[model samples]
Target: MALRKLPTHFFPSLQHQLRPFSSLNLPTLEPSNDAELVSKMLLHHHNPFHAMESSLQLHGITLTPHLLHQTLLRLKHSTKIALALFNYSKSLPSPPLTSTSFHILIDLLAKVRQFDLAWQLIVEMDQLSLSPTPTTFFILIRRLISAGLTRQAIRAFDDIQGYTQTKTNSDDFCFLLDTLCKYGYVKVATEVFNKKRDGLLPDAKMFTVLIYGWCKIGRIDMGERFLNDMIGRGIEPNVVTYNVLLNGICRRASLHPEGRFERTIRNAEKVFDEMRERGIEPDVTSFSIVLHVYSRAHKPELSLDKLRLMKEKGICPSVATYTSVVKCLCSCGSIEDAEELLSEMVRNGVTPCAATYNCFFKEYRGRKDADSALKLYKKMKEEGLFVPSMHTYNILVGIFLKLNRFGIVKEIWDDMKESGVGPDLDSYTMLIHGLCEKQKWREACQFFVEMIEKGFLPQKITFETLYKGLIQSDMLRTWRRLKKKLDEESITFGSEFQNYHLKPYRR
Candidate 1:
């Protein structure tokens, strides 16, 4: 017998159908109830199933339950798809919600704000005997809280304990409590936390969340009480736990007394030493938090000395660590040291991003040296890294406009346009102001018309610039016509414009 080739259109259609099944949001296939069709589909299935699996993997879509159920129903009840799902799930960081995949569909529906359909999916999961896990309950709990359904979220949490063996973590319980607090349900969150804390082991992570929440709500003293209780209960404080406590103290100190702040800083150092003694490594964030608090509190010299201490303790500084030092130099008007520190950053292989240049530019704000600023700008572009943001263009524009280098200003605008940055109202306004300063009233007025045609209605200041330019050039007719238009449009001319144009005529 000769083999028959399948039609070209037939294979392509099958390939297209499988390419984005989930993205296209296909309907669920009732595979278990269909047998004859299943036999026909599975007759020559190995190659087709392999092809489908490979294509779906490349597209980053899993063979969802609907996809699986249909694929299995149309073919023999084999575990090929199951095995494929396992391999794909392993490649991800978070473990796949395999047992509760149907429940997850409900979670996804909820996330997309399709609450009614999501409830239907929850009911479906119950019917299928695929119980929801704590993670599953957490999802619905968070969504309900976000939607302002505090009562519903709590009720859902109460019912979820019956669904799975996976014990709800402290964070999960705290999240519910926090939601209760947010919706004038503070007593409820407090009550729940007290009960859950008594029943479950006090996790440091959960304590950090509660303490932060309390501090945020102007209850720092209450948060401190919780902190002391956690430490007294023999639960060792982690970096986050200490950091939260320190931050709360620092915030209170800022608003209240200098003595309290100084004592807090001294106590913070003691806590740092204790963290090291207990064999808990202080991460870069831990170091940065202390440095930031000290720096903001007018203690940069101490912050710098602490950086040295951090390095001595075998804790390497991060880019944020180095950037903080450069910013401090800039703030102190030590531009030379700030520039040198930028060099140090590059040498240390902490390549400067746009933010580094932003600080550098701010230090040179009044210099307005086109040659120097443009050279630095070109160096940044040549590095083939650190694409200048909109602020960068604005700063350069201001510099050249102040220098009355209109040609250079236009060139900057051209470059900005090519970079896919359309001139904002401010950019256009700046250019028009520059034109008016040079007494090129005709060009300034034409630019104003062009800006309006480009869908940007000029601000009062923009029109004020044009009106002043005309009057200064002794083009009285043009000035009166513009004033009439302003009156018709109800645009108020401020004293700033009168001081620029009307003052000379009064003298």
Candidate 2:
């Protein structure tokens, strides 16, 4: 069975090798004439597996599954022989799979994400009375889940449950649970876990999975109670369990840090310290939560130290950690520190998200310096960094109005339109107010008319700012015109509008 290294032109030897097959007493599969034989030899043996095998040996070649299947089928061989050929080809040391093998071929194809072909092979396996292994079903289910085919995955899981009488292992349960969590099928996962309660222990990992699912969907109390139940049942919480619980606590703290039940910050610290005492090394996620607890308590300096501690423990600072630092610095109006940290973030290949830009913009707003804020906005756009959120635009417009920087205000209004940053009603109102404040009555009136044309009827403050601006310009006729417009629009103008803007002018 030595494979001779034939010459570059190997057909003569192959023709001689296949010639004996023609005289064999095996079912004769002749291709009509010598021309057909020559054609088959050139196609299958000379050109490889597409050619018929009968003439292949004459060209110093061998039969492959692809070649054998076609030759056997042409000779009207039994289906059993086809199956045998397929199985034999599976064991070959070259070219991999046989065309006729169903199950093995499907398994191989499934491993490579060729699920459509694998499904066809499964149908073939069913025809042959071959059962798919749990691994096969699991692999297919995982693929379905990743493809976001949840309903299909559920059907597949149901199929797996029906076909097998053996108890599902922890790994299988975890896979189902994770898939359920991904698709927000927590109730289904819960029912599955509960139905198999006697056979399954609610281990720490399982509890963590369930808790995280509940927490993700804003069921913090339920998640916390579940965590306590695990603790009460003497189930030791693992790192993931504690990390998720700490996250829950931080979320509560953020929502209501100064509320009546405001001890979440202390509770988070306690959990972190307890986790450390239990020999569970706090990872960067856990450390970031602890930093949040400090930040919530208005102790940014301590949060910074925790950042240093994270580095000391070989934990890399996550984007969340960097964001928290920038937020804290901006809250304290430490713009320089915030800017330096942003530079550091860029150096470390961390691009600031919109929230980071917002934090800086908010500080600039507090500084009441429209020029600095406008420059930062231009810089953000020029760098092709994060796009400003609606809140960013709102803050910018508000600051520009406060500083009476009407030119920059006009630029913002035009920029928003050109950049497809559609502003809400508040943005329009703010622009109108900015115009009125700068005594740009004609422009303000035009903007107001545009707002009405766009179906945004003027609010009470809009008329108020316009009326006040007109009075300040000592244009009695224009004030009457605005009042008439307000009356026609049925917008209730408050006394503060008239008193604040009209009193001095009336005097």
Candidate 3:
């Protein structure tokens, strides 16, 4: 099949003339059928502007609102096509302009980051006595907020108010506040919230969002102030509201330095107590936050106590809850307890995730208990609980390499492939490092070449292992060949390894 050649404007061409729609050879469009045809052309063509021109040639001066809307929908991601269509529609004797068509074009322009054109369309709509819909305002507001144009978003909101003469709902206000908070504009969000709250009765969810915003910025005091203000305004806080504040307080406390760790944990505990006393029932998330505080404070026993209390309260522990307790138990050198909890989690019909297994793997690896780690790996496979991830293989590889069991390493590597887990950069690095450590220069070289072929550039540690292994194995000639290939590929090995000379292996 032969490929169709596009026109010169599709690519950069100095000699190509830019012409109006009237000068182009366009088709006369049937308002009903040709809109669908134009839509198809825009979808399949390389230059949608050219597609629009062709459609115009087929349906001269018959551009319909439906056709323009369809074309705009197809070209929403292209600013050039949108502007071309806009200009082409303007050239018609009686342009088929409607609110729906203008909305589509404005949305298309906004999506392509041509905000000025979209705003101009809104102004034009106003002049024509056409009020923009809520959807049109939403699209503009979201785009402006996403682009970090808070001031422009505020202006648009005000404009929307003037156009509709109706009060904005809680969802709209919440969206604007959330966007401002997400982009670290909490102060601006507060001002916007205050401005809107005067006219609209602020709800619990709205207050919760503002509290979360303050908490996100580590302003716990400010968050608390809002909480109190909400109560003063006779709004009852929900479980979600309490959980948000609890999580924020616990997170801030966890980040305190060692000297302040105890003090911070105590503060988090006080908040937890207060939450329960306020008649707000603690959920799994609330318990998880408190459990995390206990873990960070090096109080695994306390975490276990809380776990008991959680069950007593009939709050079923989630996978995250089990994982947290398991992690704390492992950190405190209580592997048996952690393993017992893992079984308990399964018995309760809650499947352990990758993170749960990783906690056991890391603990076993740290203790140099490869046998236990392997048993867990086999158990993971035998139980069909979850497929072993790259981290699982990496831990096994590191352990086998440390024990100098190259044969087992090879077996695990084969198992990794048979299990359908594609090796990432870390996997390749580990295998190459393992092969080099065993002085298997030829095998290491093969893996190195394969790694490069897979498009992963070796890091400094990879090169260091290869350099040391090759020099010690008296494979100087092979090293020179590898260096030459690296140089040709423009791959750097850093200055430290670059200056090192090959010395004769001392027997």
Q: For residues 1-507, what per-residue lDDT tens digits would candidate 3 score against the true structure? A: 111121111100100111111111122323455655565453345342152553354354466676676556544434454556676676677877788777776665564345766878888887877777655676677667655678988888777678767666766677677656655567888999987788877988688877877877789999999999999999998777777677667766654567577776677667768877887666777788778777766688889999999999999988778888888898889888888998899899998888788888888888988889888877777878897777788788888888887777788888775553535556777778767766778988987865553334566667767877787778889988887666643422223234344444432
lDDT for 481 in candidate 3 is 82
Q: Pick the TM-score winner.
A: 3
Each prediction's TM-score versus the true structure = 0.46, 0.44, 0.50
lDDT, candidate 1, 1-507, per-residue tens: 111121111111112221211121223334343333332343334332252453234234444444544443332122233323334444555534344454444444443234555555565556656665665666676666655666777778877767665656655665566445433344456667777677777676566656655655557777788888888888777766665655555544561256755776776677678777978666765676566556556555766787888888887776666666666666666668778878877886877666567666665665555787777877776776676766678788878877777787787777775453445556677778777777778777776654543323455556655666676678879767655544432211122223323233320
All candidates in order of lDDT, best leading: 3, 2, 1
Question: In lDDT terms, which candidate is top?
Answer: 3
Residue 354 displacement in candidate 3 (angstroms)? 2.2
- The C-alpha stretches of model 2 lying farther than 4 A from their native spots are 1-223, 229-248, 251-265, 273-283, 432-507
Residue 26 miss distance in model 1 (angstroms): 21
Give the total clashing residue pairs for model 3.
Answer: 11
Per-residue alpha-carbon lDDT of model 2 for 253-294, expressed as tens digits?
453436622576677778879888878877766776666656
Shift of residue 118 alpha carbon in model 2, Å: 40
Candidates' RMSD to native = 19.8, 25.6, 16.9
> What is the TM-score ranking, best to worst?
3, 1, 2
